[model samples]
Target: MSSIARRAAAAAATGLTGAVALAVTLTGVPSALGATTGTASLGALRASTEVAVAAHGVNKEGYEGDEAPAGVDVHQEVSTAQLVEAADSVQDPAATGTSGTRTGIGCSGDGTSGNRVQAVYVGVAGQNDRYDAVVGALRAYTAGVDGVYLASAMEHGGRRQIRWVHDSSCQVVVDHVVLNPSDVASFGAERSALVAKGYDRGDRKYLLYTDAAVLCGVANVFTDTSPLQSNANNGGYAQYARVDAPCWAPQDHSVEAHELTHTLGAVLSFAPHATANGHCTDESDVMCYVDGSGVVMTQSCPTTHEKLLDCGGDDYFNTNPAPGSALATNWNAANSSFLFDPPAPTATLSYDGSAAVLAPSVPSGQGWRVDWTAPGCTPATATTTSPGGARLAVSCPSGGTVTATLTQQDGRTAQASTAASASGTPAPASSAAPTPTPGATANPGPSVAPTAPATTPVATLALGLTTVTPKTVAGTRVVLTGTATTGTAPAAGTRVALQRKQGTGWTTLGWARTSAQGTVSLTVAPVATTAYRLAAGTTTSAALTVTVTPKVQVSASGLTVKGAVRPAAKGTRVALVQHGRAVATTRTDAAGRFVLTAPRSGSGYAVTVAAQPIAQLALSAR
Candidate 1:
């Protein structure tokens, strides 16, 4: 039968919603046995005994709330009656298999009962006029296939029954659809609800098939083909199938057959049956390519159909197949061989100041061996049945590449590589000379021939300071100077600035640029006590301090001595001191008058005065 005809038939049988179900297996009661070593009474008693054992062992492990079993192995046989009885103990009678039934409505496949595949067909009730044709095509395609069964067309009851028939650990049911553009959101919501329920109940895997438009909208707003796009964009399972628009609806059944190939592809790609033997470019496999010519249906392709069922290059229906084919063929393919062995030990390699290097140990026993295919780097060798099971260690040689490869025993190899680059660190500051302090000079003599510009190779600019005696004159200013030379002659426009340290940061006070002779003189009014430094570009000169004293006067009344405020103003008050000792404390009566004995000439008498609070003034004399 042609693939299209078979698909159509399967669709018809399963109905519009594709709700067909499978039958559960049951075990029978055991016959009584005689005990020859016992007495005649004991033998009769034993002969009359009838022990009821489960036809099949049901593994409840890993089956949590609403979770289905991992897989059902039904190739082996036991009593159908016992299976039913066992199922009855765990499930309601309505969910149990009836006597002599080969296929139960809404039932799930059990590997033990020899049922491995369950098929369903999706179609719209009134809108899909081609439903019969589609179902007929599908049925003909799957004829005489072992472990495969077709679902009936009734929608609601069948879905519920399928869910109930399988134990929580083993069976999965996927809903398939071809959505119109307008129905995408509704379709997505339905799909999400199904997946959410599955996850809430502890089931990890789900299957879905939708049109390319829907899939593209769901997976990537920007890519061509994707499985995860449908599920993740729709917020559901990790995987899904997308049938290109040119294939299913409005097109021929050939496209439908191609989509069915995708259904088979998903099962082959995921857990319990995954293989590393295929690539997307492989024309011989349906899993490798999508079938169609840009939006238009043309001729049918047999190679396309053949690849879909090749089951990893082995002919369809082969009993003992290669791992690649086994994974690609059916959902129930055994995965025991896919297990990976422990990895080999690691070895340390040479180490540079910036990075450490290492090599991989050799794999001992074999199934598959790991190879560090990364150029100039090595990975630890290890045995594994699957890819990505070994470890690799490598340090990037300043701006280079590293690659890793895995070689299977069957000559099937896969490689992955990455690139590396170098990074730089900042230089540290100098510790030889002290940091230049604000307003200070490093030298103290009349400037000799000023050195060349600080940028010159021979002469570096340095600061010098000179004292300024306080005079009775107002507006007196002190000048600070620095010297510099440029190779043969100093460059002009050499600028310098002064900065004062305040709190945690520096505040700019004044600036001066040097002339062609490389000398700078800064003038400033001396304050009480201040520290400042001179800066030239990235370098600075040392720090210095200056002091200023106010004029003093004293008067006396008997032994008590008082000092008149030197400045004599509304803001100043006077206190008396004699022989360096304060004799009395008094404030001027707005006349700046305080009484005190006049000290002899050059006597180092001291006096104190408090200034008005509003002016922030205080004075001392010695």
Candidate 2:
């Protein structure tokens, strides 16, 4: 029968299932074939011709068709054992059946039950070699699912049987070149052969014809049983599964996952229905059809392949409740509770000048309150001052136990305590005892008198120097002031030296003596960067380093600017001056080159490069 006629007939018997109803349809095929084929005597010849025509239209229909002649004697039955053996040949080596003691292959014990999954392979009986790769990929990908069984039939078993394979633990079944070689027109020929067999039309099951013409894989899940009459009717391949044109990168696992998802979507009727020119591009879903053809083809569904599968969303995608719809929504909802992981408890103690305090804060999402208590002190309730900040204050007697308690928003509390003591005071300096002095004798005539040697006052002094500015220009004058004190006031001429710290010692720059006020100032020439220290008597102050940045002067010379017109070119030369002396010079080459040097100490200077004259052209400065 013609592809169209077979599809129309299938549509007419939509939703019919079971052996009782199938038997009635099988008995009517011969009569119908007689009318459609025209010559009853040449039934075999007519059947062969019909198969050829249908196989040619297989691509047009988007699936491989059965190529058997209508009345030609062909094997229709195969033993269950033979089917199992055939399937095992194509089975994935990794797939294993459930055995309680079989370490990783058995069902997990975490409430998923001991569902056994088996793998069986069905070999290809057709001309397409791609089926081998496709089947292999399916086996390797679905090895983790429960119970996979492979089966094969001498004749096509149709869409209902295909749906059964997907719905059951049977991971996949492969069929080789079922299309007629002579009939290479539309793919509808393949669909026709399946419809001729007692295939179920109620559950829209589709076949993907991944041939040379369509290098990309194809997927179809029909909501309605009249597979041929659906939008898949056009030459575009309707009742049609989605088709991905062949791509060079067969490693594109996302494409395979996407097609498989469509199959799963079909069984669940979860994918959006094809609409508007037999295409659905609206909505940010993987199921949405994309526009364009060839290698650069775009898809209507949101490309979650990278985010969902590549990231950690594969499990969610595999068990998507909505199937063909947006998988992201369901995935996010399932993992909402695990979005943010709470951080562990962390406590930090810091001193604000004189007080030692402990501040504890938890993550914002975790509602925790902090309370503080101390021995011989008042306990304070913890309060949340900010989204993530909790404040707890406690007053304790000197040398007491301080405890901090953390209460979670869920009403669970934990406490941590530490023993602490008040800081001690510094001891006072001791006073020196009075010293006794010798006295002269009384009642003596013309006696020799003795006098004690003149006492010398101890000269004790201290010096300190500070840098008012951290950075300065070369040759900039810097002030160094020093204050000196003595045990009995300085002799008014004690010298204090301002020195710079060298490699391992101090080098005195200059020296000054203390006045009656015991203070002195020293002025020194600033050359290179230096660190200064003040020395007086036996005391030396901390070192203070001051960095002296050089002053630079950059200038442009021999600048010639034509007019701002066509072919207008300008040339300029530049020279660098430092400390009242020319240091470097350079000329412009096509563009402009300038010389840069450090200037003498005085504020700072900058040179500008202009496109036109100084007043009219754009200017750039350095």
Candidate 3:
């Protein structure tokens, strides 16, 4: 009957959805809840109000927030549909399902059967311009993925590369959505508006936000975003990707990639209870666990949410096969959203009597390292060369475990376990002389590596850049050729790119994959002195410096010296030489022509190009 009571009734009737201060309750209530209950049950009413918001799941374990009975660890529940991808049906028991689409993204006709093109539509919490940045960052982040795939190739032989099947550009689309809210939608009521607005259905949405103390991601699909995902069971619904605003703008790309990985597909065993410690085994990987210490962990979570664990520096594309790991299975689908994906690269680790060999079965740009720990000996690490072949000897008669791991240039690594044997029998005869480790004492006993397989191996890449002629005139087309090798044999079909050095940076002018003989050539015109090199994976050719010289045209206006610099660039100095002695000097103008002020007869005339500014600095300073 009272005015305040009447107003509350009207607000409640409208299905309250706003902020906590605005929620008519407190903090964050259901986007649909008003704070007014005007009674003692305001706590109970507010509790129910917060449940009405349409975001995603919120953490409640050890969570002392306004919700969850204050100050106790209650395990939070999340739905399977809300994770980056609902994998309940697509689980890769072998962790080898080309990520989200190992069998091929279901397509039709000229299409691969059972495959479909997948797209990710990015949405913000609200429509405000402030949220536009989230969409922009998402696009920028996804663009770098293609390059990462190529550059980080682990050399899985036989079409392991995630070569796209479509000539059309989109494996995944990164753009803003008109139907989704642009503000923080960590509650159910808000995201419900997105569904009503008619967004791309099927949990393929990525929402950007500013909230820091809530759910960063969920493991399944859900119907609502109430705290702890209580209504997640029947939500068989549109789950999405969400991260704090700072996460999108962070200094590292790992966070974005990490978040995207969740949406693509995460390992089911990666939860706290699964002994995975909320991450994959590799500490250096982008998907490593972030612990309570803020230290990125190299180990699994013994208990759930005890510490904050997420991806770390070692978290890069895990193309290395992970027998049963979900990360490997989901990598392709997560990266491209194409139902079709390529297999992770493959390699073999074996030992002759003395040396351990890690040989690539495919062409990979990535390097590898194997740690050899004999039955009772200290572990020693040996790394592969650029094109990637690593051979290190373990002490004989002490067979041990050989763990092969993908190695990073930054010295980080992933976790893997495999077996290695070095002994209990006589060493084999040496096929070739042992390559000595610097400062290592030669073993008294002769050691032989395993016999070479029928096929020669790809080696550490060695590249060379050369022109038919080292010197040439400006504008003259010159034939440039490059040679590449794995140091042991000619590297065939490896990607070789041409680059020109400018200042401290190198720009790619063009690229040609290598021929069977490991050669790449192209024709180029040099207008000025330029240095060029060839890059193959992590190896670069020696710099080929080409010196371009220009011929000048000289004439006379009765001793008034005149000349044109062939390149037509100014600063050439023309001298009037009388019997090989300079009688007058002048510099060329913008048109590259120079003229003397008065007449002076000369036996001969010559024009000299000005020294480069950098080389003339000392002379000018004097």
Q: Candidates' TM-scores? A: 0.21, 0.23, 0.30
For model 3, the local distance difference test gives 0.36
lDDT of 1 by residue, 224-268 (tens): 112221211111212222232212221112222233322222223
Residue 81 alpha-carbon offset, candidate 1, angstroms: 99
- State model 2's lDDT: 0.30
Which segments of model 1 are wrong by more than 4 Å? Answer: 1-461, 468-475, 485-491, 501-505, 551-575, 586-605, 608-622
Task: Quantify how close model 1 is to the true structure by its C-alpha RMSD in Å.
Answer: 37.7
Candidate 2 C-alpha lDDT tens digits along 1-622: 1111111001101112100001011111222222222123123322432211010113233333222212211122221112112322222211123101000111112211111111222122443223322443333233211111110010112000012122121223333434444322222333344445422132223333233332133333222111121111111111223222121112212233334333332212221333311122333222233221321223333332221221222222222233343433222112221011222333433221112234433321123444555556443233332112322233333445555554433233445555443342211211111111111000001111112211333234556666566576544556666666556454365545566765676544334567787767755434346788876423577877877543322233233222111011124433333333334444443212333433332222223223211222222333
Local accuracy of candidate 3 as per-residue lDDT tens digits, 105-188: 111123222222222343344322222212222333332332233223322211122222221112223334443343333333
The number of clashing residue pairs in model 3 is 71
| Model 1's TM-score against the true structure | 0.21
What CA root-mean-square deviation does each model show from the true structure?
37.7, 33.7, 20.0
Error of 2 at 595 (Å): 70
